[model samples]
Target: MRLRSLTLACSLTALTLGPVAHAAPHSGHRDATTAASAADKKPRPDDTIIAVVNSIPLTTRDVENRGKLFALSTGLPVSGELMDRLRPQIIRQLIDERLRTQEILSRHINTPPEQIAAAIAGIERRNGMPQNALRDRLAQDGVSLTTLIDQIRVQIGWVQVLRQELGARGRVSAKEIAQREDALKRQDGRTEYNLSEIFVKVEDPRHSEDELSFTNTIIQELRKGAPFPIVAAQFSQSQTALDGGSMGWVQEDELDPAVISMVKQMPVGAGAISNPIKVPGGFVIITVNGKRVIGHQPGHVITIRQAFLPFDAPLNPEHVTPQQQQTLQKAVKIAQTVNSCEAVAAINQQNGEKRPSDPGELQLERMNPQMRSLLEGLPLNKVSRPLVSTDGIDLIMVCSKKEKNFADRSPSEIADQLMNERVEQTARQLDSDLHRKAMIDMRIKLKGV
Candidate 1:
């Protein structure tokens, strides 16, 4: 009887190991006994022949193909450990999805097919890819269009379910909105801080038991005085992680509400650490180092400039044919010869038929990196290098620079910013709470991926 029970349990378990699955049984957690008896045989992922979700069979083809898809998309080295971490998160996610799908069906909520198609199209466009390009990208990550479609269906269906399950009739009182508005008005000229932080990225929403436990352990270590920079280097998912995740002191309003609330409650010299901040993939552990005030001065006469490259985008050196290289050279030539910011603007417009005037405000404190570095040690009226901005080759002329004075920030202004921050923090906590509680048969493990 136990043998048959174990076999049946294993079959059901595979469903939870949807894409890349992992399972290790340990004592003292809910479902621990069940996990031990069923998972003791420890079937290798490939050996797990079939997955049954609510008695519905899911073929190995689905899981393997999905795994291949995930691997191709990320382009990261897929070590044994990576696979082990990927499995449980993927499986649980799929299980939740299956459950969500059933609820949607039971509610009889309909997601217009056209709406789903439009949404998918918008996603592709935002990624700057053609329809076929999206498919190619997915294929590169080992994903099939079919897989994407299925995922989208599940998501759209969920939206329908949410609309039906949670009615949107709830309203924020006028007094609440007025209070929030006052909170907003208070932020003007208020001191923003300059600080550095290490943010450990949480990428997987449905974490494997091992991965969850591992991250929790890391978070614990971080809470216990681990150096922010060192810990970030080891675990943060941000590109800035290489530099200890130093994006510099973020504006209070710019931080994740949870992070900001935690910081607000602490003193200046004090650093606050969070229990993993969840993301679509995993968790982010943030440790703040410091903060400063930020603002733009009206006397801060700023000149913003950039060279345009029109539709004549650069050549892909990797696969550039001679003709493509020639076209790119012309664009580069036009960009290199522009002598001054004004000249660049004129030339940018000279090709009236070539590229439109792409201009933006020049905020000294918000200038791009290269310009910020170049102007840092130099005095006023400095002509910066052709800094690469989002538009094109750029240079800046700081008309003036002045110290931020208290006259710019009135008490009401200060109070408003502080209050909005307070409200935002509350809203964020509520959001996290709702998400955490929404899971079914959810297992949270607090030890190694």
Candidate 2:
């Protein structure tokens, strides 16, 4: 199965599948290693059946292992209270996974084993763990590697199923692409929101209150610092759930009026969660990640060269090692003498720093105030004073600066956006159809004890 690796704090824009294989504990939570040790002390009987999907038995051990996986991924403690809160959602997610996997297998779909291995490798890379480390970590947390692998397999297979269902309908023609481009050009100066969503579909109007209560519980968990993407993957019924609920950048006009109103009031920089905005067939909890005025804001894109000097160990401000002191002295001298970006590169190469000489173009507005202020008015070909941190010291030289219009998206960008919209619509339709046709037996109670 071709799986995209999941990150601890996943990109709010990408479609990533799989659990956070190597997440560290968040602040106010138990250390991940300690939590894993505690889980290892308690083991469940493997043969206890919790639920059955199309005659496929799901064991209590399966539920418990998946629960630990969720805790690890979201940085939530695996305490009794937390487990009790998560059990229903975990069961629902497992059921959906089973349904999707069974459908893919019925059609005889095959995902290459190498692709699955590559996805696992990607998980390790993103987590900065060594090869084969994911399996060891899962074992430490009392979760079998199989629990994660099975989920990845389902995700990969389901994607193929969606593509097959889309067939030719997924493609956007040149005329359609042009129409979208023209439309965007006409509305060039409007506002657009960078948004993420968690959509809970109201299957039965009579049960709307139940759905609302369930969504509220998810919101409570999110407020308690559970990672939003992981929660979305586990509980959101929207097509974009696999993508961590990212809707990319969308104009306010493209969304429902209720959602647009919510986005209008949200602030920039940090994400703001909205009250459940009732839409046609569902209630959506929106998070406005950011907002920008189209075609008006000119961002300063700058290219710079940096020479870094590192110490053998982390530098302590109160007690500096002689080696660190010597490195800082060298950095200062280089900053004073370097007259050109080329000289900065040569200095870095000569010192064997191994850092990139050119770290590519960066948006000036996105930088921290200290670095931005230092370089904002700096003339090209001049180096700044040494910027010291715990890891190392850096002397940066401005290479070039240019103003780029953020709203002037190219035709390819427009085409991609159109394709995403089509895919989302198709996915929702197919998912609903699957739910309608599948023989799902809910033997386990998902509500209150």
Candidate 3:
């Protein structure tokens, strides 16, 4: 998974920043003079410096804004108790971010401005807003756009640093790729999970309790609505953090025993490992994106054509409108008469249905249970009974169905797996080295926070 900017914002803000208080600016433009004036007026005592990472100061205002952002994003109440629990972790995260960014700067790794703009544009597009809409949203939330941009810059720059460390070794040789492919072939028919993870390292066994507490807080935020990817990006110790902690598809044998067990139990889509699973040096929180029975399952792809007959207004079953009844009759007649995909198209054209005749191909396994069952034994080119949904009555015709063995692995796929493993190992070592050598000064009293 390429860590999209939108997911990063969702993960960073939902659980850390609460709902935006101010109204969005209608113009979507930043007023520099107004911002400067507002800043000049902010000399509150709460804005005192909290901590300094190296020489960079982090302020109380920063913590407060992040707390609000988290609250807003996760829909969690920003109570004093919650802030007390979150303050330490937030400070740690910010300090680490500063360290990573400073390291990147020391190495002279420069992230292009265009890349940042593109990332912002992606965020705007994903949120269904116009260009520069993020600025307005941040302003409404009482956050500077620079805060988000700086975070993104750090993340992007860190990736460059890792890539530099990986160097030519990141590339998998043909022989190695072939070996991986062969190994995968041997493991055919085994279950594999498409997983993402956030690994919190415990440098010393004595600190395990603190790490566990921190991990639990992260899980709480995630369950509340924090984006898993952004959280992983910001805090995961593993190299895969560069890619939003995506581990791609891995068989049970390839993972830590605890992780394997967690993967087996986790349901696909949004369901995460409820508790942190302990491994060698740290605890891991995982999200199972999906799973498949390798080699045994077929990649079932289907193309279907649908005709939608929308009611003039929402249908009321108790008191149906004449227009709704007429539309339902027409849908039923089409379902009864339509035998082929072409005939379904003709019916849609005849009725002047505004919807597309071909809605495109859909993965069989990805469809809902009802839709999958309806199409399970459905004959090709045959129209089914009209399926009434909230939107409209749909007449579906299965245009094509193709099944291919999903287990036949490709060379590039195997190569990527190998590369990821190598990168992960290298990343951990580098992070440990950085921590050992860095001058980190914690000014805030974490014990009381």
lDDT values for all models: 0.44, 0.70, 0.68
Better of 1 and 2 by TM-score: 2
TM-score for all models, in order of appearance = 0.47, 0.75, 0.70
Model 3 lDDT per residue over 131-208, tens place:
675678767766667777787788788777877887888577898987887787788777888889988776676656
lDDT of 2 by residue, 36-95 (tens): 234434764766666777888877788788877777666555675556545555666677
> Pairing residues by index, what is the TM-score of model 1?
0.47
Candidate whose TM-score is highest = 2
Q: Ranking under TM-score, best-scoring first? A: 2, 3, 1
Using lDDT as the measure, name the better of candidate 1 and candidate 2.
2
lDDT of 1 by residue, 259-294 (tens): 667666555545566555554345455555544444
**Candidate 2 TM-score, C-alpha based:** 0.75
**Count of clashing pairs, candidate 3:** 14
**Error at 198, model 3, angstroms:** 2.4
Instruction: List candidate 2 stretches off by more than 4 Å.
Output: 1-46, 302-362, 367-400, 447-449
